[model samples]
Target: MNFLYLLVVLLPIAFGVGWWASRRAVAQRSGVQVSELSSDYFRGLNYLLNEEQDKAIEVFLRLAEYNHDTVETHLALGNLFRRRGEVDRAIRVHQHLVSRSGLSDAMKTIALLELGEDYVRAGLLDRAESLFSDLVAMKAHAPSALRHLIAIYQHERDWHKAIEHARRLEAMTGEDQAPTIAQFYCELADRSRQHGARAEAREYLQRAFACQPACVRAFMLTGQLEAEDGHHAASVDAYEAAIEADSAFLPGILPPLLASYARSHQMDRAEKFLRSLLDRYHGVSPVLALTRLYRQRDGERAAIDFLTAQLRQRPSVRGLMALIDATMDKVEGEAHENFLILRDLTTKLLEGQAMYRCSRCGFGAKAHHWQCPSCKSWSTIRPIHGVASE
Candidate 1:
């Protein structure tokens, strides 16, 4: 029911109808039927434009009955029904197209594809899967079919099948699905880790690294596994590698990484690494981590000085909050009350802000996701770099 999409579909049909009307008019020298058909077509379009979908559908259905041989009209009607969330109507229209006696094999496959999509919209995934599998076997629209099958497998959490089909798609299309394939491996690794199958998890992580050498999620998982095994130094290495792999994920990576650095008694190394990040990565997270480190080692005054200097450069609300908290202890009476109010306001501001967003679809999230929940694209959701966020 997208207005533009409706126009695009109906305009072609109108042109065809007008052409047919001209032919009949020349042969019979009668304009009555042609005038009625044109009026009906325009009336249906008007009804659709006015959001009178029921009336529009009725008129289009009559048109379909009159032009039974026009396969494109049926296809467009089915697509329109699907887009309007009338999945049952869409399925019936596509089924009728597939069952028609004189339909070409090419047209039949297109109808089958449309029917499969309608099934998906109706949450009949098993039926959709069967239809798409048949299309793949026939090698008619195999790429599209494989993509849908991969989506279905991902929805069902069937990572093995998803990975297999992804590989097949890559080989078929030469699109280099390595990054997506790596994410699937990471998913498998996470599942194995949750089930306490450490070796299996490690194997999956290895495969993930093989697929994409600089995969940040794989490196992060490796760090987590090493940390769980009490190998703090190795965990530190993996975590640092993760940051180096993708600095955009620094906000998510910093906390656990800092903990590992502390447990391994690498505060000096931590300071050096954080300082290095400041040179290239302009984020409040690294600045805040450095502030805490300085407060623990060099004293409050030194921490405040460093944070104050960094804030002048970054201008982060989080940085401002840190500065307020650091100075609150030095204030008294009305000054202390004012500082408390400021802190609460900053906390509220931060609370409502989206910390992560999908680069592909612009879907905002408070937490990081490796795959976009909206577009289902892998490695597209990353930390939002702004004064209120990263």
Candidate 2:
């Protein structure tokens, strides 16, 4: 009991000494007597630490009043509000800073940048873009503003603007943006191809390749355009180069490559290319392609035998589904009924599964994308190969 009394007595003394130390630390930092404001600051900090948000906001508001001339205080308060999703408050605070007549151009630029970020958070992208564009034009925080402009253009699917600003940013910053510029060109090429401006599409693809020597997207687009326009031989050449550049894209490339070869009646090349693909790629697409090639040349029985052997090695649900479908035609009675149920279950299993994923951000999708819509990274979304999936 005496020990408890001693601890209680020492606790207040310890707190008082610690308070003095804290005042000293703040005085050293702020170059002012924070002791007068320390009580409210500590109370606010305590509320924040304890997740008492309402009281914390009240304390910070008081701190902002006590430190009205302190730019750092206003910036910190606005950033805290922004982090808490109070973007309107953040925008208002940053706007006030930007409007302050005597503020340094550098400080005003910082506040404008923060305000632009707040506008983005609020999904007011048009407002954000204008502010950031102004900063870029003024050459104040140009690189950061140009990056934000590029992001805005990408989000808006205005690929041309993105390409222009990305190139400008590269020139200004001396950073390598070739990969991104190639992707932007690819986007333009795709749009041109879809709109039947085939010649223009090819021009953009040439630009993509110029930016990135071995750009897989440019190769793919070249193959696609050639194939669609009945230049099967050229299409095969481009698709082959696409695979050589990046074997990870073989699944997408091979389908078109094989189609082009078949269209040109080049069965020999198809076999040779697919065989080479299996050697380079461990994914099931090549295996399945090989199975079909065997089935076409030999017979159904040969295809079934080939698939069963490969499935033993890879064990895929899609392969199993194919195997089951192949076997169902020859089955009878309860065996056939059991196969039907199994097929249905497998179909359901695959129904909700994402067949592709963004390598950059792990965003899952049912369809493939040459560019990640989430992270805006190029050539990142790819086939998700596995047992119960693509």
Candidate 3:
């Protein structure tokens, strides 16, 4: 039962016991002691109702001391401290409870878990990790501890360890974690690529595909690696596959697609892919990219005409900047000066704008994060569709 329910039931019994004892005391001596105890109880209740937490804690602590067997009181007090962000005090309380001679194994593990959480909240990650590892080793609270350990490894950027723990969590809970695990493998591939371990990077990317066949990041990485090795045709195929995997990532796909098209001299295929993108993507990136392509192939006038027409359909700050750049070369005197000032103002307007946001937690970032920093949700942060961004 909850503490409040127990208190409601036991407080009346205690009051009756006190009253009967007071009646006996009256026969033996004066009523002074009974009146003092009654007044103290009322004072404690008044402190509770007033939300005078310090005084309430003082009263509760005294009552628990007087009634030494009250495990529920101590539990309530410990939970209160934890909720108040007094994690150290909560740890001490829970530790004391765990050390008690009569505590059940279940209660002891619960206290230990609470204390481990306190360690985590206090930024004592090593201590928290060790404690949670012990819980997992003992197979008590293994699922919760494994979840926490996976989160800790993620925070530490230990993707291999995170993947191991996540696997354990899935096994213990019988829950599917392939998508998240695939992202972890992608992280491993990215790390290997950064360290120039091409073989290891390819292996991890292959593992990511095994876990999630439509993993776009894996495809993008494969395409980049293929291009770096001068396999331009394969690179073009992989980039196109990446687009097919996740068209929501159009901004990231376009630059590489354009590069691959340039490398393979496949303007026809590039135009077809870009046209398909224009139908699906509301962002201005593909529009600007196509404008550049037109200007390079045809002329400035054709690009300008295309952009001016597209701007009416989807106005964008970046499109405006592109327009100014495209038109400014032909502009002269006061008009050029005015265009320069306008460009400067537009640059200022977009200078500090966040280009991505975590859909789950609303964490704004200049660059995208696969997992939200605030909420730790996977694949939550994406490019913001805006006048200033894609």
Please provide the root mean square deviation of candidate 1 (C-alpha atoms, Å). Answer: 3.1
Give the Cα error of residue 86 in candidate 1, in Å: 1.3
lDDT of 1 by residue, 289-317 (tens): 99999999999999999999999999999
Q: TM-score for each prediction? A: 0.92, 0.86, 0.83
Top TM-score model? 1
Residue 322 accuracy (lDDT) in model 1: 96
lDDT of 3 at 143: 93
Q: Sort every candidate by TM-score, greatest first.
A: 1, 2, 3
Q: Rate the local accuracy (lDDT) of all candidates.
A: 0.92, 0.85, 0.84
lDDT of 3 by residue, 264-339 (tens): 8988787777777787878898789889989999999999999999998898999999999999989899999999
Residue-wise C-alpha lDDT for candidate 2, range 1-390, written one tens digit per residue = 376865676568458646764766665675354654666666766576677877877877887786666565577678878989999999989888888788888788899899999999999999999999899888899999999999889888898899999999999989999999999899899999999999999999999999998999899999999999999999999999998998877777888888998899988888888877666677888778878888799989999998998888888988888888889989999999999999999999889899889988999988788778798788899888789765
Better of 2 and 3 by TM-score: 2
Global lDDT of model 2: 0.85
Q: Clash number for every model? A: 0, 0, 0
Any residue pairs clashing in model 1, and if so which? none
